[model samples]
Target: MRFKPHFEKIRFIFGAIVVVTISGCFQIFGSGPATFIKKSFNPSKTKQAILFWKGGNATSGNSLQVSIKGAGDDLDKAEVGNVFTVDDDHGKARLNPKAIRLIWKSDRQLNIEYDVNLRTFIQLKRFNDDTIVYRTFKPVIPANHMD
Candidate 1:
């Protein structure tokens, strides 16, 4: 009867040790929640406008929405069929289409078809480029008109 009580006590202690060892291993070896880890590793692949027209009239084709892709946003917004450019970065600047008269990048230039009065014009092609270089004036016949 004495040996019976000792055996029960040993059995209880051995079972408790096994349970605690298994539990400790789980806590030490397991990573954080699987979902949270996966979410942090992979980001959403959404197409956001790296450069977008915050304000532009798309109906008249005054300004175009240029993107990383060769294709641009088909928003037609313009006033008097004119768009202005400026040296200001991240700020709105007035553009005079008459100032340059013709601007192009590569073979792609501003394709504007205008009536004699200059009331309205349709843009047949858009100047799509990542960078633009301007030429200084050298005195032309009409001035401000590039030949």
Candidate 2:
């Protein structure tokens, strides 16, 4: 007897839903999933930031990392205890005046905010998928200065 293609497709979809539901249930009940989801969606409110230095290439690293430049006249003089938020559609980083740095090797695009600086970058990878793998660095500079 021959099986119908439609039946196979339905079976595949049903199996996938079962797998997802099982995982979601586990996540809902465990701290691991809760913490993972929290961090994944809201990284900007938890990570720390450091100063930025040139000479770092984005193409030669396992993960893309972002750092704030602290030498600019306006940025260097900003209050030391200030805080900022950095985010992409996929994740976010919460940073304080210490300066914000992030390494996103699995994200394609990101939106970062530091003090008054907001910038975005497109991560480059080997696939046509929307999952970009890149890092972005933003500083507490004026909007006009961002490129």
Error of 1 at 78 (Å): 52
For residues 1-147, could you state the per-residue lDDT of candidate 2 as single tens digits? 356888889999999999999988754543210010011222333322233221112232111223222222232322221222232212232223323333333343223323323223422332222232333445444334434
What is candidate 1's TM-score against the reference? Answer: 0.25
Top-lDDT structure, candidate number: 2
Q: Provide TM-scores for the models.
A: 0.25, 0.21
Top candidate when judged by TM-score against the true structure: 1
Model 1 alpha-carbon miss at residue 125, Å: 37
Summed backbone clashes in each candidate are: 8, 10
Taking all chains together, the TM-score of candidate 2 against the true structure is: 0.21
Candidate lDDT scores, in order, read 0.30, 0.32
Candidate 1 residue lDDT tens string, 43-67: 2222111222223322222222222
- Model 1 clash pairs? 57-76, 57-77, 58-75, 58-76, 58-77, 59-76, 59-77, 84-95
- Where model 1 places Cα greater than 4 Å from the true spot, the runs are 34-147
